[model samples]
Target chain A: MKSSRGLRLGTTLFSFTNEFHARQYSTEQLILKVAELGLGPGLEIVGFQSFRDYPEISDKFAEDLKELLSSCKLEPSCLAINADINIGKDRTLTVDELVVYHEAQIRAAAKLGFPVARCQFAAGPEVIRRLVPLAERLNVKLGLEIHAPEAVDSPLVLSYREMYVKVNSPYLGFIPDFGASAKALPPSFLAHFRKEGVPEKIVCVAEEVWATAEGNFGARLSEYHRRARQTGAAEADIHKLNMLFAMLSKQKPSAWIEIMPQVVHVHGKFYEFDKDGNEAAISYAELLPVFRDGGYKGFISSEWEGTAFTDDNGFEAVQAHHALCRRILARA
Target chain B: MLQTKLIAENGLRATSTGFDVEVRLPWYRGLPLSTVEIGDVVLNGEAINPASVSIEVNGKTRLPGDLATLYDERWYVLDSAMLHVSHSELKRGEQYDVAVSVNLRPPYIPGLTWAVKDAKRLTANS
Candidate 1:
């Protein structure tokens, strides 16, 4: 039997993708602290404005990181490829240029004891085709992220999978973000809740929120708290109060693992933990059993999202999640 | 902190000694990307974009001055100093505009990458 080799619970510096002022936590702090916390299943390293500069990844920095992780015994989770594709200057990437970017990531990952390098907006399958040979040469996963507003059945899936089948390559794959699948929900889908006909004011803020931004309300429980001061309802237990109602409202478990085999690492996301240290919104009782059944075995790092921790308790929250996720994955 | 966007909607190509500048609408204008030409020299560029203004990135400062001569059109890129624009000027909220200059690169390369020589916070203003 292929036992689940899941590596659980690590942090993404939290502030990196979530905001622009990401330097509140330094690279050294994020790395050394994760090791200090003993949350070293693997560390997702951001090689951009937070730690390094553009066009070039730092060689000296990479060597220092290698020494740190080796002493601390942490494997690299992944490397986020930075693309400042905004407006004003040129932001498009040629395949060759992308290879150069990928080369930097590959070299960084190898030095830090990683076989997979994760990229954000991976253009298309042709880019993957070009990257597979490079990844084969370097031995890495040139990952494209399947995000929300796009599903497993979407055209993007067809492209990635078709490239895999046609080229029959293993170097190219995907990082199936659970948050994206969690985003696939209907507007009128919340009517079937057990706590139905309750106060509309409870989930009122959340409802207004999912309407404008990304639709996957289950993954975005934290965003509600951000706008709550403006909504005249910002207070304790505000976001989770809305989330508990939202989770119970789901009619089905949802098709989350459709892009799994391609996934190298997971953003082990959760909002609540029970007396026994289990997630509240998600049914791991059912989900872990599913992974066991499907032979799904790999890295699962906890990304404790939600506003409960704040800046002061970020470390505490991460430690708690690290312990809880370790316990869960140990059972598997 | 100020930004401007232009597109070379038809096509743009420049020589070591000569360059042309044109402004066109963006792809949102239902024009083609092939028509959009951004000027880029590997490490730097000199743009006589307008009649009297000259913008030059000689691998250091984004120096803007009065237009002088033919060197106005020729771009200079040092061995490792590539010049690129990180984004376009999405004026207000609309998403289209055309620009001209040999300074434009096709979304592949960044304009300028730099390191601070001696960066520190001032205790107080001089």
Candidate 2:
């Protein structure tokens, strides 16, 4: 997984979790299986629920696990930690709670000798800024994942980047989920318009009406929903999505770089693949060029999350993506 | 006589001669409807013209199709609550020999007014 100048390739282990359901493989066996991926320089173990039940990680503890990665000839890219910020439940936390809950994970990551502990953007900017000093002192960077359906061109993203620059801390970085990158609207959308049974004239009129209305993002989205429903244009939904993704790739270059310095890990996701072993859901041909050109030499974890959860062709899909990704990285 | 379970996907439109009814209404989200014709014009059911109102007399089976059309079609006139032209008024429990066609659209938020007209009525007491 190296470039022309030896840029190493690594990915998350979450993608292959389903594969080892065979023969009741242990976590060490899974790590060995991940190393077998021939894909990773390592694996970022996800902690977002019952993943901790694996025996190898539970047996040796963090130090042993750290030693084991080296022993297995693989690197520990990151720890998938769960911090209970509960942004919806409570907006503000006292400084002590912030340290106890938030800063503890950063310190723990440092203690475990990992460079990063990914944090959820649960609270607002004030919280993120407050924790930066603690993260810097712990010598462990915090990478907030920019995930999907939440586009990079999203106001939330713009606001996050603006806040990051204003705060200007080295400890704060981002892991822009490549899945989100793939989740975009394509540029060529006239065919979609036709599928929705909506004439361009109707959409044009609706857009005109929407502008003057006090339509926020939700309102605009609902209005679009209404139009699609009105014109019975379900097929137009895909075209609309393609248009959104294209918008993201085009607009988020600065945002990408702004958060890139902090990107310790990334979730490279896929939805569909083709016969020649290319992802059909998105044009990685277009996006991979941007990631390489943008100097994003980081972990592109194959987060195999989609309808694949129900597919009999489980990790086979992941393998194709891995080969496809290797090809992309080689070109990069 | 031919019939199909269809929908007015484009919704109902009002025109001078007849209405362009996209047969999509209610649960029939994406069904295709047969083009119904009576006169030279295509018999699209969503005609929103300033037509007549149904009295007790129009409800009888003896009334013709054009009268039945006027009876079933509903339009919102300026300042009037809404224009409802129908031959029969069948209450919930009062069983009567009734035959009619109704095409409905899911309540959609208009890009203009934020009025939840159909949705309001549908979910009002529920």
Candidate 3:
């Protein structure tokens, strides 16, 4: 039952930000841990954040990093890069300046042997278009992250799809984060809400509205507000509910097939894993089949985001996530 | 992730004029140091004097009271800016809770912003 499509498992060092900050693991140790866990042959890195001397990596440092990865049997998969439009107070980066910034990161990614560089939404079509030639020349793919709150049919995403069709280039693609396909609100958010004294009845009301609300996001939000108010939910509770609505999307897992071919990398975004080794929030059971059927041949890095909500150890969470992925992929 | 590290290996003496602390800024594309405003430095719930703050970068020190104008170059990646704070209240071998408020220039998207208005406590090593 192995997937005919080549969907390799991997992970990003971001999962262990808490551990890194706690001094429990150095960057090299984290890479070795990933390898030791058998979680990856593919490793994605946030270049600036992960490296000690970022934006100024010496040749010796680069060589040392390469040697470490080689020794650990890990391959550089993607280099997550930032595109900060804000240059100064009220001074934003021009398109030309953005091109220069991204080009430099792309070159760095290439030099580090990463095949892909993930960019943020701030890198608009203009900036991405400008970087296409450089990416092509460097033999690296520039992937724009399609994270949560952005649906599959969003106008901005569709515009990128149109550009891809028009340009017909392999260098431009999407890195769909599984957060968009999440079926339930993150359990940690619920725990916080309840800890803040939000009534369970009110929480149920919010969940019902989220599951059944219709029309556009704005319309659905308004409907949720009206319904929650009728239930005598406090203003603070209502505000928290609104924030939850904004965080989780209502997109179906099968909807990803629309952009499947353009997916260069996948962020296997997860919150918590159950005792049964399943994601508590996201519906990966339904999502992986779409990739398998659509013939996606890329790395889906297990990105454990639970640290944002809880002090749950990322190393343990990622182990559960990869185990879940292996079970699902075996059935596919 | 943003972090603060005290550079004094011997720990701050009670009679010392000031001590050096390195503030590791979050990784972003590129931000001009001029736009970064470091607000009050709070130590164990007490606020430090703003006038006594000086910043050092690349071996050059600037005490213009404005962080944006202090640094000669902009910041990109996960870079740490050295901050030198002058105060007379620090005690030797004391673990003081340290916190600093920072406001970076807002990116084009309203959501991609960084600000610390409330003091977030950090554990200091003696």
Worst 10 residues of 1 chain A by lDDT: A15-24
The whole-model C-alpha lDDT of candidate 2 against the native structure comes to: 0.46
Quote each prediction's TM-score. Answer: 0.55, 0.55, 0.83
| Tens-digit lDDT string for candidate 1 (A150-215) | 455666577777778787767676765544434222233333221434334535655566544443
**What 10-residue stretch in candidate 2 chain A is worst by lDDT?**
A48-57
Tens-digit per-residue lDDT, A59-175, candidate 3: 888888889999999989999987767655556778998898788888888888899999887878889988888999999999999876677788778877777888889999999
Local distance difference test scores for all models: 0.45, 0.46, 0.74
Q: Per candidate, chain B TM-score?
A: 0.20, 0.17, 0.67
Off by over 4 Å in 3: A53-58, A193-247, B1-15, B18-36, B43-49, B55-65, B69-99, B104-109, B117-126
In model 2, state the lDDT of residue A134.
77
Candidate with more favorable, higher DockQ: 2 or 3: 3
Residue A200 of model 1 has an lDDT of: 48
Candidate 2 scores an iRMS of: 22.0
